[model samples]
Target: MADTEKTAIAAHLYVALRRVANRVIDIEWMAQNEEYARAIIKFAVEQGNEELARQALRYQALLDGEPAPREASARAEATPPSADTVKKRYIGTLR
Candidate 1:
């Protein structure tokens, strides 16, 4: 990649990392920006974060109007929800 492109990707990766720290994943960004999604997947792999990589792949598939792979979908289904998601799901009921 050109230096400018690399810089842009780096900047976007930082934003993506920040979102991850905030427990937020912008699937919309991943779906719309192929380079950003690739960057996230590459970063996740380099960092040995399989879950994040899988999520990026899934988001890419969804945004590209393709069904996720059956095995990946099954594994994703088996994965437990994040604590934040659980809280959000039950918060209204607790009111």
Candidate 2:
């Protein structure tokens, strides 16, 4: 990858990892869409974006109760509020 593209990917992953670590920027969003993050990480890694992959790894470290670089700090309610907790349920008609 070119330097410019790598830089862009690095910055994007940095902010993403920072937000994931903080857990206050977008809790529901992240919790709901880790697939997107994983996809980006995979692409970045495939493209030889070490910095980007490092950023991705930092989030895993944070989840593992290990120290991770910080930037800011998901800093939600609704029974099964977010889709993440959604489960199949029967629906009843109301008058």
Candidate 3:
């Protein structure tokens, strides 16, 4: 295959993988399996691929009733906070 064709094929595969990951996470959530849900997100994040991570995040948001994964208060608390997050919390407390 040509370089362009190969790139396109890879892009398509990434999208398909993201869709599958999202579905799996959703099913785990509906089953009330928080551990499995976290596992899915961890897998996606560890894959270091944007699409997979985004899909995992989307599923997390859906499970948490948030607009986005970053807005998931429970998930956010479990994960380590970033520098900016710490700053935000400190700033909020000062108000």
Best candidate, lDDT-wise? 3
Clashing pairs in 3: none
Stretches off by above 4 angstroms in model 1 are 1-27, 60-66, 70-95
Per-residue CA lDDT of candidate 1, range 1-95, in tens?
13333343344444555666433335456545667667666665455455555544554454456764333356657768944467688765965
- Among all windows of 10 consecutive residues in model 2, the one with the lowest summed lDDT is 82-91
Instruction: State in Å the error of residue 33, model 3.
Output: 1.0
Error of 2 at 17 (Å): 12
TM-score of 2: 0.33
Task: Report, for every candidate in turn, its global Cα lDDT versus the true structure.
Answer: 0.52, 0.46, 0.52
Error of 3 at 75 (Å): 30
Query: Could you estimate the TM-score for every candidate?
Result: 0.36, 0.33, 0.38
Model 2, span 2-93: residue lDDT tens: 23233433456656545544322333343335565455555545544555566656554544446655433223342334433332232353
Runs in model 2 deviating more than 4 A are: 1-31, 63-95
lDDT of 3 at 51: 66
Tens digit of lDDT per residue, candidate 3, span 50-81?
Answer: 66666566656654655543433576577787
The whole-model C-alpha lDDT of candidate 1 against the native structure comes to 0.52
